[model samples]
Target: MRRPIEFKLRRRTLLAASAASAVAVGFARRGVAQEATAAARPAGPETSTVTLTINGRERELTLDNRVTLLDALREHLHLTGTKKGCDHGQCGACTCTVNGERVNSCLSLAVMHDGDEVQTIEGIGSPDAMDPMQEAFVEYDGFQCGYCTPGQINSAKSVLEEINAGIPSHVTDDLTAEIAVTDAEIRERMSGNICRCGAYSNILAAITQVAEERS
Candidate 1:
């Protein structure tokens, strides 16, 4: 009887085959992952260039479209006076004047206001020369922690402007008639701003003093 030919596989060959298979599988997975990542990537310029007239000065900035006006001011411009509280447009800590009107900066996108005018707390006053509203706030102790003082002062100024401009608020009794700067009017207009320090009474007093002085 003819002896049967026996074939044996080398351990080194088996190990090399296993390693090659693992390498091939790894390359396949890497290629798939790269394709998925490329597909998920967003197309277009992620940043936009906008020119804003902030505090009576022209400022040109190239910023991400997703950045809010508040972030643009506080982060890019280095104006930290506009506080970022809540960041949901609920707390008015990020309030600022855009085209002479008070707006929640957090709610506005920087790219949307390409050629808009903005006024922040820094524009309102300075340490050496404070605005009348700022002075009143100091006199009446309108703030405790002072976190919301900048927004409070900004809103207070706009409140008077709104009343003077005949913009009727919710509490206005007569829309056709001239609006009065009553407590209700002030409260209704200022309801958007939230003061966690519970200094509403003092804030009211401060605003009232400014109103009276202007009147």
Candidate 2:
């Protein structure tokens, strides 16, 4: 009877220790997660002035250090033409022209482009007077839901411009030779821009038409 009682006491002690260890581990994990969350959070309302050329005009703004170019355009500047699809660089829905080059606005900080030229769809054209690329999109049914239209147009325009500028893409045959505007080339160049509605065929047609007209 004495031996059994001793063993029971030991068992209870072991169980209690295991439970305490588990609790400590859980608390440690939670602490790590909290630290990560805090690290990811943008650090402030501290502001600075930024001047970006949107479309054709230069707009000045005072923005937070953490403010993304996408937020600056949509939330601050009141230019909502640039859609925030994934808000990550993956979707390319926030594609915009920066200094004659295309970039994912969501991936860029507003302060990074203090003196850079930024162009959104709104700056590209308006409802009454649309750019040729915008007109092509309309005529070719390049968009279905239209949520991704602005990004698609911006990316498409950049793809053409890049090709014209002799920039080689993954599909380009020769690095030294001028890049030709082909379906494969367009597809490869615009691969970063995702269209969930799958109007790919129409989009291709529109891009092709623009390439031909410009050539």
Candidate 3:
């Protein structure tokens, strides 16, 4: 049978529209598959095993290659005392002693320090017997809210060691020798540790008092 010219034209248009819809759906599904493939790819080279000496105990942890040392300590080991004020190493809240030198724990990665000694706030003292620095902080009221106290005490201990080792600060006249710990010296050296409680005056007093007693 011969169909009308208008009817034939309408049928052809419907077929073309159906084909176009099917093509669009196929592209959309392919895009979703590509996204899933990308997400399923394994993490790159930075992931590995790390062994650290924490609080006089040996511990092993497996972490992503990009995990920061601070995260390894806090998230992996459950040591929450080390606060993360600024993960960019700007704040010293995550400060810890590494081989007798204090460093911003967040600045380094866990995998970078294999067989390294790490000392966090919990490692330094205990609730039953507090370390001298902890006691000094408490007695002098060096902090309020106490978020930065751990880093402050750890940094303070290192500052005294640096002073005894003849390290110089910005206020030092000679760069080659250990600098004395005056009020200004303590202030300048301990500036890396910040307390939002406006406790600078008391913090300086605590550090100065402890330094003199040790001397």
lDDT of 2 by residue, 1-215 (tens): 79999999999999999999999999999999999999999876898998888887889999888999999999998999899999989988999999988999999999999889988898888889999999999999999999889999999999998999898987899999888899999999999999999999999999999999998
Model 3 off-target regions past 4 Å?
1-46, 176-178
> Model-by-model lDDT, in order?
0.93, 0.92, 0.89
Pairs that collide in candidate 2 are none
**lDDT string, candidate 1, 71-109, tens digits:** 999999999999999999898999999999999999999
RMSD of 1: 3.3
Q: Sorted on TM-score, highest at the top, how do the candidates line up?
A: 1, 3, 2
Ranking by lDDT: 1, 2, 3
Q: What's the CA RMSD for each of the models? A: 3.3, 9.4, 4.2
Which 10 residues in a row give candidate 3 its minimum summed lDDT? 172-181
- Write the residue-wise lDDT of candidate 3 on 43-119 in tens digits: 57666888999988999998998899999999999999998998887779999998789999999988888999989
TM agreement with the true structure for every prediction: 0.85, 0.78, 0.80
Model 2 root-mean-square deviation: 9.4
